[model samples]
Target: MDNEEVKLLLVKYITGEATVQELEQVKQWISAHPENEQYFAQLYETWHNMLYLQPAVVNKDNAFNKLSADIEPKQPSRYARLITWGKAAAAIALLTAVTATLYTRYSKNVESVRQIAANPGAIKKIVLSDGTQVWLNAGSKLNYTADFGKTTRTVYLEGEAFFDIAPGKKTVPFIVNTKNYTIRDIGTKFNLKAYATDPFFETTVVKGEVSVEGNIDNNVHEMSRIYVKPRQVLRIYYHPKKESYSYTAPDTKNLNEIQVSEIDSAKLDRYDGWKENLLVFDGTTLSDIAKVLERRYNVTINMTDAELSSIRYSGSFKNIPSIEKVLAIIKANTAINYSVSGNTVNITRNNNND
Candidate 1:
């Protein structure tokens, strides 16, 4: 079903107005995919929160009396039951409008967003309304509003994506917002990797120039906007704030650090080879590599050895080979061994390591 139809069904389901068939349909949809379940859970939470904020105040005694009077003579007919359902639906619609109004009044720079997601083990390519092309990697999500190119050209990213922004609109800049940084394109094509689970964030410019700035709310300060040219990569190492004993004055000194380095023009594939269905890992840690492997193969990788997990490896695979072959190659070179149980791979230190 389309998003709107699914949303309507979900609304009815949440309001306890859905028929048995409708409830079963919603259940099937939610169980179809992990994203569907997540979306439904989020919507459910939002509905409850909104209800809490603006309680639907109804005179219980008066409503009960009216309901009794309406059905006092005999059982209500089909038409009467439908009329009651319609009134309840109208009341829900009004409540939704009031919640939206309250949200708009309290929130800043809020807009209805359209989210696009790429599930694990899959890649998706999409063209924006303004001709900008975007390639979303596995386990990634991109969110933007309807007024994309007309009023503002901005999108929020929660994973990795390669953007080839369409030129000619000099007045409106294309902005990509991540959790820790904001990347503003300067008529360029770039690859941005900012997975929330990853310890580092990276942006590699393939052509033209782009500027990167740290998000102030993330406690990253004193760094001005840094411009990255073609074949240049910008990496940010995240340093999470630690809990302190003294609550009076918390230390916010250790913010995320940024580093910029130039890459060989010929080695652009090391950054964006995934677009061509190539898996490239350059000095990537085992733990980080497991994350990528998990997304690529749709499997769970558990690293039992901390020291083994920190071992860095460099390799490349073309045409998306099997997970077993990839792990076999790593085992041959490294001091680690792995066992597969169903969809889970358990990695541990090899006792015969030299």
Candidate 2:
């Protein structure tokens, strides 16, 4: 079936209104591809969260119409309209929640806010209301409010994204907020990587420049702002216990450090190649590389030996080669052997550590 039909069936299935045939169709579609299953899981999580939300005074007809217009301009099917309001109330609420979360009028005058997510092994490209283009990497999320370009243009990010920001009228200043730092654009193109699970946060500028400021004790450290030029990379090594780096914290002096380095054209390509479906590893340890492989291929990789996991290798794979091929390449370069069972790959050290 077409995408719209599948989506409608998924909604029906979530609301307990799908017929047996429709249910089987959804199962078949989900089983057909790994991405489908991931989509369903995300959808189900949103629906589940809506259950705990207090019911707001939402105009049902207006909400439904807005949802339909946003999702698809075409008319919804009769079956979609016939769904019992009692059964579809949660779904409708979910749609409303996803579209915008209402805030008090005094708070930034924000009318609506939205979030976009890219599941593991998927990359998504989106254009903001302000005309800025963003490419979200696998397992990343971006959040912005309705009044995006009115007074200030800012986006909250988790994970990685490549941004080509559109210059605003009167120079409103585009800003990206992460867990540890805030990057202010100087009318530039840049890449930001700040995954929560990662020990380091990095930003690489491709064109123009950006100012990187650390967030300290929930405040922006204006004094710590660092201007980064094109071809320069700013990397911050931080620990979870101390979320941010402080200029005065002696205890964290060793735990947190900032480094700015100049990179060659080849290194710049390696940083931005994920947007082109390229996986590049430059002297990355096997353990760390496995994390990237897992997100890119949606598989579990287990290294049986600690020393094997610490082995560092560098290589590049374009167009997303299969997990087996990637592992084979690694095997050829290192003294390692691996076996795949279903979606899991187990790695063990060879007889010699050469």
Say which candidate scores most in lDDT.
Answer: 1
Angstrom error of the Cα, residue 40, model 2: value is 41
lDDT of 1 by residue, 1-354 (tens): 654456567666644456667878888886765434543543443433222221234343443343333223232232222212244444334334433433432222232456798998889999999889999999998887656776567777878999999984554678887754668874679999987776677999999899875432243333335788999998877564356322222122344566789998778898898888888888988987998899888899988777977899998889856789899988888888899988899999998986
lDDT, candidate 1, residue 138? 92
TM-score of each: 0.65, 0.63
Query: Which runs in model 1 stand beyond 4 Å of their true positions?
Result: 1-111, 216-223, 241-253
Model 2 lDDT per residue over 113-150, tens place: 46788998889999988889999998888877665676
Model 2: lDDT to the true structure: 0.67
Q: In model 1, which range of ten residues has the least summed lDDT?
A: 75-84
| Overall local distance difference test of candidate 1 | 0.68
Candidate lDDT scores, in order, read: 0.68, 0.67
